[model samples]
Target: MPAIVVERLSKTYFTYKRPPGVWSAVKSLFRRERHEIQAVRDISFTIEEGELVGFLGPNGAGKTTTLKMLSGIIFPTSGAARVLGYVPWERHAEMQRQIALVMGQKMQLWWDLPPYESYLLLKALYEVPDDAFEKRVHELAEMLEIRHVLHTQVRRLSLGERMKCELLAALLHRPRVLFLDEPTIGLDVVSQKRIREFLREYNQRERTTILLTSHYMQDVQELAQRVLIIHHGQLIFDDTLRALVERYSPSKALHLRLEQPADAETLSRFGRIVRMDGLEAVLEVPRELVSRVASEILQSLPVYDITIEEVDIDEIIRDIFAGKREAGALVNTAGS
Candidate 1:
């Protein structure tokens, strides 16, 4: 069975509108003009059990809103959604116990108390057995390497440590489904890597269905096998990361270190030069012609070392959002 099923799910927010004037404000007391904002448009998708999917988008793209609906935090304006075979908005106890939601910016742990104390509260709330709770807490804390600080106050913990503790809390119940919103946000590179490694291992061992939303491309690149991209409150792409790069990126990058200095004019014959600095140059060439162009450059130019690179995922996503590339075709092709 699918872990999640969303069909034509959408959320519209209604807010009062008023002109910037004292007279307009006074006149709006009895009657006010209301404006409709589509936070999430008609979007539909399914997530199978044990799949780790990446949810990607820029600011205000409805990524969090969709997560909220899936986690039963908010109600949708239209359509339907089921999480773990239960209507999420209905907030069934069984479904609630089987799923976990963690947002990096929000803290469910108390600030002044130690994390262990918070764990006690959560254990009671989740109705976890005593022996199971003890085993899970220590295991997660040891894996996250936060065991030494579990007794320390949460406010005294570093940002990375707090995030780890958050993960420990979320996983204490052994939830079958996990929803993470920017779980690595504001964390340093080392902390980010550790968390990613831990998540990858945990997913493999537990077969947990995870849906993660993050701005950091490395998080998606290293951890997600499939990606779902939302733009302007709509899902523009839904496919594997490799498929996304293959379909949307038309060119490959070539990095060259020359044995002799070559001017930009000399390199222009081979491909569009992305950067030219001293004897090192970067070029963008058509994907289909990369082999031919590289061969010609080796035969013609004074080349010391050359390497081919796929277009950066970050650049491709930026182009899609900046209107440098058309995503309408992608939506049509992906049946979004």
Candidate 2:
């Protein structure tokens, strides 16, 4: 069964508009102007059990809003969603027990208290047995390599340590579904990589379904097999990362190191030149013509070594958000 199901789910926020002036503020009390902001608009998707899906979008692209709705923190204005077979906004006890939401900027752990204390409180609330709780905490702490800092005060821990503790707290009950919003934000490269490794291993070992939102393409590239991209409150694409690249990016990059120097005019005959430095050059070639172009270049030019690489996923996504590329048929309307 699917771990999460969202059908035409939407969230619209309403706020009173006020101009910057004492007179405007005073007048607004008597006559207010209400404006509607469509935070999430008729987005639909499903994540199967044990599938780790990447939820992607630029700032204000409804990524966090959608997660909040699915995690029962906020209610959607329209449509329906089910997490672990329960309507999330209903805040059912069973469903809540089986799911976890971790936002990088938010803290559930007590600021002055040690993370161990917070874990104990969570254990009590979750009704975990003493033995089971102890084992779970030890196991998770060991896995996260934070056993040395579990007793340190939350405020005293470094940002990376705090994030690891936050993740531990969220996973204490061994949730079947996890919702992570920028979990690696503000983390160092080492911390980010460690957390990614832990999440990948945990998802595989526990068979937990995860929906992760991150600005770091490396996180999605290394961890998720499928990605859902939202833009301007609408889901623009839902498919494998490979499909995302293939459909939106029609070109491949060829890096070549030549035995002899080549001028721009000579290289232009093969493909669009992206860069040239001495005997080394980077060319952009149509995906369909990459092989032929590479063969032609090798035969015609003084080629020492040549390599073909797909357009960077980061560049492809950037183009999509910048309106340089269209989603078109890549938008998965069925949302399955």
Measured by lDDT, the strongest candidate is 2
On the 0 to 100 scale, the lDDT of residue 103 in model 2 is 94
Q: For model 1, what is the alpha-carbon lDDT of residue 156?
A: 99
Summarize candidate 1's per-residue lDDT along 12-41 as a digit string, tens digits.
989999888999999999789999989999
Lowest lDDT block of 10, candidate 2: 327-336
Quote each prediction's TM-score: 0.91, 0.94
- Candidate 2 clash pair list: none
| TM-score between model 1 and native | 0.91
Candidate 2 Cα outliers beyond 4 Å, as residue runs: 19-30, 262-269
- Score candidate 2 by lDDT: 0.94
**Each candidate's lDDT (Cα)?**
0.93, 0.94
Candidate 1, backbone clash total: 0
